[model samples]
Target: MIRDSYDVIVVGGGPGGAVSAWFAARGGASVLLLEKDRDIGIPVRCAEAIGQGGLQGILEPDPHFIAHEINSLRFIAPDGTRIDIQQTDEVGYMLNRRIFDQELGRKAASAGAQIITHAYVSGLIKNSDSIRGVKVRFPAAEKEIRAKIVIGADGVESRVGRWAGLRTFYAPKDLESCYQVVLGGITVDKNLISLYFGNEVAPGGYAWVFPKGDDIANVGIGVSAAMIDGINAKKHLDQFIERHFPKASILACVSGGVPSAKPFKKIHGSGIMLVGDAAAHASPLTGGGISNAIAAGRLAGEIAAKCIADGSWNEKDLSVYTRMWDKRWGDNQRRLYRLKETVFKLSDDVFNKAAAVLVSIPTEERSIKKIIATTLKNNPKILLELARTFF
Candidate 1:
């Protein structure tokens, strides 16, 4: 029998929802996590890369979900100049999202959170000015589930946020339409992730090749919709693959949109809150969201539990979530967004020059910090912006 009421109802079962449900249940709140898909993390859409030590405080590392460990990065310029940088102190990982998501959902279940997959949330349950719960549709029936608070961990095209009257829409320039393919039978550096930049390659975005193992990698391209110029993301990605890995065999294909804008000013209102992509918490520069989503989900869950315990469900009470997120990541995201805007405006000539400058740097000083410093030496304005963003 499904309970009609819960302390918190979390919509969507990605990293954000799973983490939110786990933390909320762990905090003693009666939680319900709903996933529209029959299986969590199906049809992996991400590039599957995360920074080293990103999930240390959030989720414990599970070998079952780690596909590859990366220790270096290579940036390829428009003119085919490759600049390699090794992570001497920090590393990253390529995750099997299908396994990682299911494991996260399992963790949430273990924490006393009830999960229901294939249950699509069709509408919100409202009481006066505050959100009360959600209307879910099952294969055989449609039902209502009530909650003290509702958390939307839905993706870029989130309806939950819009239903709650939040500005979840992103401008074309602030959205990245991405296309990716898993390629096998190709030779690639198993320990290094590569990024390719140029208008012809990705127009306002970048292309990436993240290794999964020996001879296998997830190759993808993200193109800003505003800069697509009549072409689609797949077209750009196809051109890149043909030019570089012409012999690689395609294994799987995925496409999706990512929000590349700054976070909304408000992620919470009354008894509702938005986390992850719904909140636009992704990194504008790199289009990375997994780590930030997990972090935001955990914080939202903890705060939701507190609200339940204190019997405070008003917007003002929930505003703490927004404040905390801004303090933790908002500034960094804003800085990165500024950098992205500036970098996207650079011409192919500028990119070629930057790559040339980077190649001139000694191998010992080829760190990202030094590369940026050397490349932007000719552009005092951008260099100043970079300094302010980092320092």
Candidate 2:
């Protein structure tokens, strides 16, 4: 590991940190990105579905990292009714995160960011309440690497954000305890993703079958921490799989927590900035973060670089990140959180009714907007919120 001071230091080698390091280094800042794990994206924690629009500026959709291109989705209701939404314009990707995250790290490295895996960052180096750098432990040695700006992209259980006195706590209602398995020899529509709903399937969350290929898929479940009792996410997932794909082979398994709360009020403080799950940047309703993480990473990195060049790296100097992010996505996130609060609590009967209504619509005219329109006929109280959110 390179032991020295730097202009920017990013904790975590996930997409957020890698993208941040890429931009910061490309901007001519000496950047160091550290990952505690042996690899960048091992033990994948997500459903690995990302919208195509999110990749426009950052990277192209290369086959190397894209497992499957998704153009349609099926929403399976409690009564086994399926509402299929086929989109010609809205394309998504089922990513092989192992390669995708490594590609992000390579981009950071190629842009002149120094990266070292198995480098565990224990805490921050602080002076008079101003962030200075990080204290990291390598496989063989412990060292303190100082930097002008330190970004915390260390994920849901973020000690760096805590160390920096940032708001990183999520109430039980906001956290999703998730479990997933890569199943092989499973038959699925190669071009379509499926979402299964109902209390028996996922309680307060949902179950998904994201096809990686015609015969392979990522099957997962996310259960709301508040709504679940003694039943864990894995047990919920196993039961779902037994009912759905009983003959499938489980090739891999992973479980992790996804924070779906609002972003931290203070994403940046003094010389510190938190991105990715550290800031709770994932979608509250869907728990999707790749797009937002990339967006946040790029913004934070560019801002950090500009601020560093201007010789101003305080909390106020970085407040521009907050404003820009809020302008772009804050209101949408708030609206989604409200929708999730209402939707996830809905009983199986409501989901069944909604699914029946949605299925009745012509498949060619079906979309999320149609779902909202249907909801208006059922629940007039949330019409305003739904309209403001989707339309």
Candidate 3:
């Protein structure tokens, strides 16, 4: 048994974990970061698409890690008619997530945090209602590492938060099954992101074409949990690509699920905290998490530092992270989740009708939200209910 101790232990080495470890170490706490994967980032599971605007509050992602920069977005309706919308603000980027995650981990290590790869945390060591440390299994053996604070930076299947008796299970309706194919030898504009939406295509979510430099693109689709049948996401993705970009050859394929729910009510407990996907920090509107993960991770680490600095570690003291995140981002997620629920319930016929109505609008007024409102305008009762729900 290789027992060790630290002021703070962060489980998972994704962006969230890395950021938490970084900030905790910066705050002068001895931090230990653990990852189940042999490396910081591998077996890419994300579409690697995010808006540059989403990253404003965190450390700027270095240019070497961004695969592509996009200035416009194209929307395709159910009938295959497309609408090209130029963005007034910087809109999108396709990232090299493998490099990105590694850089994040490196930043934490540079800040004096120790990292251990290939370590899977099995369970939390608890003293009645309080957490004390974690039990980990590594390639060589097993060990128990004690810590004053444990941060759950693990992804969606996180057992750390659940083991601590936190609400970590996502509702079926709150998840979107997604698939992505990184294609090379494809000629695309390289500066445009394409989004396709309709019940016939993506169910509750949407399909995206994120260009990654010249001759390459990351194409993907997200379908609601309710839409996943015997038909898997990859099969649907293949069909979509075959019909849309018949000549493109795939270089890599990725599959995962995005949690489209609001953040959990209880992410912080005595001596324990949950960050990133473990706490459902992904935005409900876009099904994006990278930026939010970094933001939440930093906040959690800073809060942990304060708790330790004050020599007080309790659920109430740790509530600073929960309170700060809720005040900044949580309400928006809840509103968007409610909006997603309403839209997902609409049938293809209704969506087609909505599309037709949207195309008729002037180009100057054809906004995504405006189109949705106009489509539902005829449903005065539902429109009123929706307004109340979102507003």
Candidate 4:
């Protein structure tokens, strides 16, 4: 009971938490942001490739946070056939996530939010059925801070929403177990991002190579957790690398999970709201989250501040956050998720046929969905089967 209260309390000082704190402070609310980690963004867990279109006007990325600019994509099928898609100037970036997270937290602080690291939130502080604040603990201390609104921007393992009784569980098929390795001594096109797709390559998901420079890159795979049956992801990744770039030197390795399901319908309840990965806002097709994280965070922060200003923290008031998120990104994600379902069900012949069609297309007309749909058109039965199963 330190007795320090704020207008809004944001848990987890990642991109979402920091952005929400920034917007909440900008909205004139006193805000507190807490991070369990000693630093705002350490222990990198992402593939770190963001689309240029995804990161348009929210905030211009600082130079310190951008590792490289990508201008094209190279899609490699299971048999090693490749389809190169030219990137629009408005698309693709390789980010330095640690610096990115720190800058976002700093921005939030500049907007008047108080930030504390190594301050793990242990539970929610509730007044009857409404979340009043959070109970937090640090290395040598513990306290409870009351607030008008509590935001759960904590990642996939979020406890804030769980404590507040929001359902955040993901079925095994809906979560991707990801492993990435930054490697040097590998020659990759500095202007091209690479993706590998095949059930054997990455069951239920895909593999990627995002070039950091001409000779270094981030190589990784996202596979369904449900598909991990005695085949360790790290082993598969190592084998792939050894087969493709045997002479490359490994720089670093990281592992984490990405949620690919539609966000929980009840991300906001009572006086609490969930955003970012906690709300499962990562895009389904790419498992790319930075853009959606910032989007959802800003929305939640704005809605929370408004609710506080109006002195109403009821579910109905908080529903604005849900509506805003749906209007902004929910439909796109749902459609992508459905598409992913069809993709994961595709067989080797189906994938090869799709690749053949992509190879047949003029370079200027090659696109992701187009290649797959065109190949399926040659076999209407297969297209109908996919559509029936998906739609």
Candidate 5:
């Protein structure tokens, strides 16, 4: 049942929304978390990989949610040359997102937040220029749930941000159309994750093979939407699987849009705020957003509760979220955006040459920082640009 009012109402029950509700309720606010899907984590859309350090900081590591532990990553060139780098400092894990998301929601409910699944938010309730609440449609009834603060953690196709007057549209070049399938009966290196790069394999993006275990993996490809002339993501993925894992059995399939753009200039207006993909907070280069989403949601929730306590629920009061986010990840995202644009312009031959160069380096010295520096060595101007932005 929907409450008559709440101190905060968060839309979408992904990591961002769940964590936001968790923090908000922990801060003594009456929080309501809404999920359009009947289940919290059904229909996983992500590759479900997270750095060990980042995941540990968000929540205690649980064996129940971990599908595989990855200690190395291999990058393959168009010509089949591969550079393997062991994770001496940055290990990661493949997660069962379905279980992981539901656990997050459970934690939020334990913190005193109420969760309502299958509640579709149809629109924002506007009180003049400010967003007062959300209008939700349930299977049995429709209700307008009012709140002092409304957070839009509602993924890439979020209408809440648009309804609140935020510019949330992304350019075609700044979006990635992705498709993936869970494959069984295939033998992959259980301790290593693989990424393949080439126009033929995945135009303007990359294909990844994240091992779920010894016999199963999530193999997927992300193609730059603007570069997909007339082909679709699934066709590319199908061709890739046929060539790489011909004997693998397909178990499940998923497709979604990944935001490859920089975060919006404004994330808050009046009493409303945007987080996660709603604010386009994914990394421009890697298209990874899980770590950033959790962090953003937690920070936004804390700020929201504090604003309500202080009785200051205006744009000025909520602008702290923007500043905090920028200081934490937004600035880094801007730098990555520049690097992404520059790297995507490289020819296939250049990528092969870069891979060859990386392969020549000693395994111990093949840190990502060093590899990137060496790759751009011939382009002094681009190297200088990187130095100015990163250093």
Candidate 6:
């Protein structure tokens, strides 16, 4: 039963939206979660890889969504030299987003949120300076859904943030135009995640091969939009596929843009809050967003619900989420954004040399930290920057 209004309205049914709705409902708010897609996680985006510790405070990795457990990863340089890393702890997970996203939506519903698919939110229903609801185009009819707080968890092309007048623009250098394909019927190291780097491979970004099973992998590429003349992530990805998995069958493919930048100066307005990619929370260097999105989503949900309880869903109340995010991931991402500006511009030869340096380390002694220490030992400042970027 749809209601005229709710305590919180979460736009977009990605990880961020699900969690936001979940926490808000748990906090006793009437929550509504809307997904524009016909189904949750149908058109899978991203390479679908997340670090082991990435979900620490979120939720346990459910077997329903675990596609593969990664214990090792390989880095391929421009010259074709490979640097394989054996993680001492749990490395990461290759997610079956179809299942992952569905389960997240299920959790939100289980926590008392109302979930609706194919609900396309066209614009915000604003009341003076603050947002009061949304104008949505449902399959059957148009509707005006209201809420005390509206969370914009919509991805890169977030209309919610723009509608709220938040700064959502990104410089070309900070945007990664990405294209990914799931290749089947090919033999790959199922437990390993591979990264291919070189200008010839991905230009300003890198190509990734994340295994989903014994004979299938998500092969993809991300290139900086500024580094290229146009939106060419798909073209670069096509070339990489032809070279490496020529005989494999592409089961699925997707192309999109990922924004990576310092946390927005303002992610909240009078009655709206933006989380996930809407807030430019993806890693500036790697362009990964799952972990960061989940972290921010939780904060947004909790804070939004708190504001609803206090009867003050204003810009000031929502600013608590900003402060919390800044304390945790704000400084770190800002540092990475700075490093990305400097490192992502390095020449292919420099990347090759760095890869060689990493490969030179004995397998038993190899660690990402040691590799970074060895590669950037020449510059103490860069070394310090690298040391602080990981956590």
TM-score of each: 0.97, 0.96, 0.93, 0.95, 0.96, 0.95
Question: Against the true structure, candidate 3 has what lDDT?
Answer: 0.84
Q: Which residue pairs show collisions in model 3? A: none
The C-alpha stretches of model 4 lying farther than 4 A from their native spots are 1-3, 369-373
* Tens-place lDDT digits, model 6, residues 1-391: 8899999999999998998999999998999999999998888887889987877866788777888689998889889999998998667998888888888888899999999999999999997788999999999899998888999999988989988888788888778888998899899989998999888888778999999898999999989888897548898988898999889999988888888677889888888999899889999878889988988998899998889899898888888888888998988898888767666666677777677667778998888778777887754545555555544
Residues 262-321, model 5: lDDT tens digits: 779999888988889898988899998888889899999999989988988888899899
Per-residue alpha-carbon lDDT of model 1 for 131-210, expressed as tens digits?
Answer: 99999999999999999999999888789998999888899999999999999989888899999999989999999999
Pairs in clash, predicted candidate 4: 52-92
Name the regions of candidate 6 deviating beyond 4 angstroms.
378-391
What is the C-alpha local distance difference test score of each model? 0.90, 0.89, 0.84, 0.85, 0.89, 0.87
Q: What clash count goes with each model?
A: 0, 0, 0, 1, 0, 0
Error of 5 at 135 (Å): 0.7
Query: Can you give the lDDT of residue 291 in candidate 3?
Result: 84
Q: Which pairs clash in the backbone of model 5?
A: none
CA deviation > 4 Å runs, candidate 2: 378-391
Clashing pairs in 1: none
C-alpha RMSD by candidate, in order:
1.6, 1.8, 2.3, 1.8, 1.7, 2.3
Looking at model 3, report the run of 10 residues with the lowest lDDT sum.
Answer: 379-388
Model 4 lDDT-worst window of ten: 53-62
- Say which candidate scores most in lDDT: 1
What is the per-residue lDDT of model 4 for residues 281-323, given as tens digits with 9 covering 90 to 100?
Answer: 9987789898889888988888878877888988889988888
